[model samples]
Target: MSANPQWDISKALMVARFFHLLCGARDACVTPFLTLYLRQMGLIAPWVGILMGTKHLIATTWAPICSFLAKNYQKRQLLLIGSLLGSAAAGLLLTLISPLDKALVYRFCNGSSSLMLPINTTLEKELAPNHSAGIKNFTIRTKRSQVNSRVMMGKGNPQRSMFETTDSSLPLLHVGSELKTPGTLVNLSLAERTRAQDRSLALSLGEHWLFLLSMMAVMFWELLSAPLGPAAADSLYEYLDFVDATDCYRRLWVWKLLGMSIGVCSVPVLVVQLDCFLAEDTPRAAVHFYGYTAFSILALPVCFAIPIPNFKRREPGHKAIKALSLIGNDCLLFLLAVTVFLTGATVANIENFLFWQMQDQGSSELSMGLSVTLSLVGEILLHPFKAKILKNLSSLGTLGLGLGCLSGQLLYYSLLWNWWAIFPAQIFGAISNGALWWAVDALVEDLVIPGTERSLSVMLRGLFYGNGASLGSFIGGFVVLHYSLAVLYKTHCVVLSLWLVLFIAIQSKLPQHRKINYSKLLAVDTADASDSEEGAERDWLIKAMRDEHLTGRAKNKY
Candidate 1:
């Protein structure tokens, strides 16, 4: 790596943190407020729910659109444009009318912001340290996770089965398909396979000018982010999966996603309850509560940083680094999945509730601000745990526990109409989010995607999550618009039940193994007897074991 004093390690870390914060604040400011704004315009709860869900629906629609651009245009430039579009959406919200106008603007913003996924993931990879990308993934994911939870409100749910928060659409990106040589096939034919391809495009004068304008817009927003907010976590899952022959990155993602997705669906019911409770009283109290929670979550990244493994230099032959990076990458995927769902839900829930409340009472702007602040605080509580809890539990076990808590939280909150009841449910924010941060990053590292492909894998993993969130949000809105609160709650519970089943199924397949040889220091410390004496031998043995566990090697190589 080349040394540039202007771009030191600390600076890079700071930039990554800043980027995460920007996304968080923008998400937080919009979701809750968008809902509130709609209600003020005379839309009913059903309409508000539908409108809010549109955010995710639009995001899903745009994932492929943004992915196409990402492959064809300068990713950074596309992201800048996305940011501007998001700002335009916010600006448009100030002038509201029929639900249709609101929906159109919301969808546009959702799709535009969807472009951020690939660019954001790419930037995180760029800022990461070469050998200790695990730490980098952990740190970036944690920071972003917390921001997402705090601002977005916490994960949402369609059946209203988890902790309630605001919701937003998760962005998606497509990276052609799995890497492959020209013509190899086992189960599927070439026509059946989806190839992950990259195509380069020429930059024209018009494109360059548009890029410049977008950059300026992003800078404007970055300056205004302070005094505002939005964010989760899971990271060690990859290590456990690697050891467990049946647990691959894809399967673990399915389970973690199930838990997180259920949470995403729950936000609106909680919002309605909160809105009704505050209808007869002061709504500002709720906002203050949200604010307090958001500020609290900002402390989490520092907390997790204390326990993460660090590598000061590259590993010899990059073997240890490769393994660690793979684990971290897979874990990152899991964490991103959880956080994205939480954020999307939180943003959606807050918006739905705020719209219902504000429309009903003609509440002051201050009260609305306070409500958003309270949601942000809830997310803050969630940020720290992304990496901390994984120190003990397997990815599935941790997620299972989190989902169980979420189910209980939803049912408990649904029974009580009091505002106080909302607080107890919000507690799930920390546990579910923490697991996301710790478990997913570990998965990424354990997967050990090569540097050349790291950016694509991370983006695609993000797409899976973003796409799921979009669908979940849309369905949640559909349920809200068509069903009673009871129906909504019951539906949420059912979805969560299904999510639990999927999680269990995936968990059942997880492979178990002993810990990796962490006896080495500085990537692959030669001073350590383990690294020098047995590193290669152990590496071969581990590979042989995994190969046998996977498909049973037909022939063995020395």
Candidate 2:
């Protein structure tokens, strides 16, 4: 291939969009479902948590090392493509592992969800869009919007929504729109309880061995996938600069949100269509893993096509050292790290296990899909206003706002009764997930010791998203095991509340010299900048990444 080869901006954007879309879809297919998928394998809550926590732990630790090695060699083409293919192969291998496809304890658990059927199903004429079941599925609502749960919680049948579709005059109910009572193992017969205990005992015999084995498998999977995030970010900036699209770079990431919704929504469709063609006992959830593989493989080809300009760069070790040096000098640095860590812990809770909780509430796959779509929509709608938000909330306050939103979302989730109500609550994600990321990214950009901009970003993200998420998932999993999902989410709200107070206290006490220049980075996310403001911010961004001789010291404060 020729060096400095040109790609048309339209062509580059199309390729870039496709790349992100497919990757987002690939990740979405498995992410919201993975913990529940593990649960379907007869492992309880803590084991699932351990596996996920370890996965994040490995991914985070390995990521900075991957970046360090890449900078040393300065060749990402081979590594990026290899990671994608390897991650895809790992997912495929996961699907290939048997008995996990079916929720086999003693017999196949058929389904593991407990979504409530709409209250007026008999009076209704059509099922909600989320429900695709046509195969004579019978659910009797005890109250309007309450699901007639035949199976216990966490035993929702995937096939009911996938294979049982009909045009009959049966009123379509939104399953788990309301719960008649808080769900538990209370309603089972003595004999049924005995059988459940027997199954539990049997599962316990092999639980430890299996947990270790699954943990290893997932750690291996994440090892291949973790570095891709930073690599993708790097490639994104490079591609944008090549196409002269840096001015609109932040908004361009909206494609990722769009793609994630598509991927999540696609799962129910795939499960339904595949069930029509597959066998009686085929594992329906396998569609998630296999579908993810397909998208990842599709994205592999697009990786080669992205016009990320290849260029020589220096080793990032000294830069990393400079970034780390700030920890000692900056008093408020601890507070920032704490906030990011807590944020990561809470976010990992929501993304990793929220659907699993909803499933326990008798939620359907279709409803979960809608939940994800709405959450992403909220993020897309709310993220662009970051500049305005910063202008009003100021640095500390914006960070607090993000944490507040996360806490509120967790609070809402803990009290979740009507599954339909969960849709509106996801608006909290706009601030918690999207605006929070923007605020942190911008703060890192502003607060770093000048030339160590990129290094500091990677370092802090590794701390929070890697270690913080891992720690939170580990603890949160046990919480779900001992208490309930509701209790765990409520606990998250409490933890966030305390963290927020601690954060504000520390930030308020910080001297002016220790604060970061948040105003300078306000334009970090604004694509709608006027002509005068746009030129300065764009140049600063471009030069920040490229300039080796950056002309600033510990001048910027947060």
**Which candidate's lDDT is highest?**
2
Q: On residues 173-285, what C-alpha lDDT tens digit does candidate 2 reach at each position?
A: 33443332334113546574454445434434555555666776787788888887667767666667656676555556788888899999898666644332243433567
Writing each residue's lDDT as its tens digit, candidate 1 over 55-111 gives 445444444444333334424233434434444333332332222122112212222
lDDT score, candidate 1, position 43: 35
Task: List the RMSD of every prediction in angstroms.
Answer: 22.0, 11.0
lDDT of every predicted structure (CA atoms): 0.37, 0.64
Displacement of the residue 86 alpha carbon in candidate 2, Å: 1.7
Best-fitting candidate, scored by TM-score: 2
Model 1 reaches what TM-score against the true structure?
A: 0.47
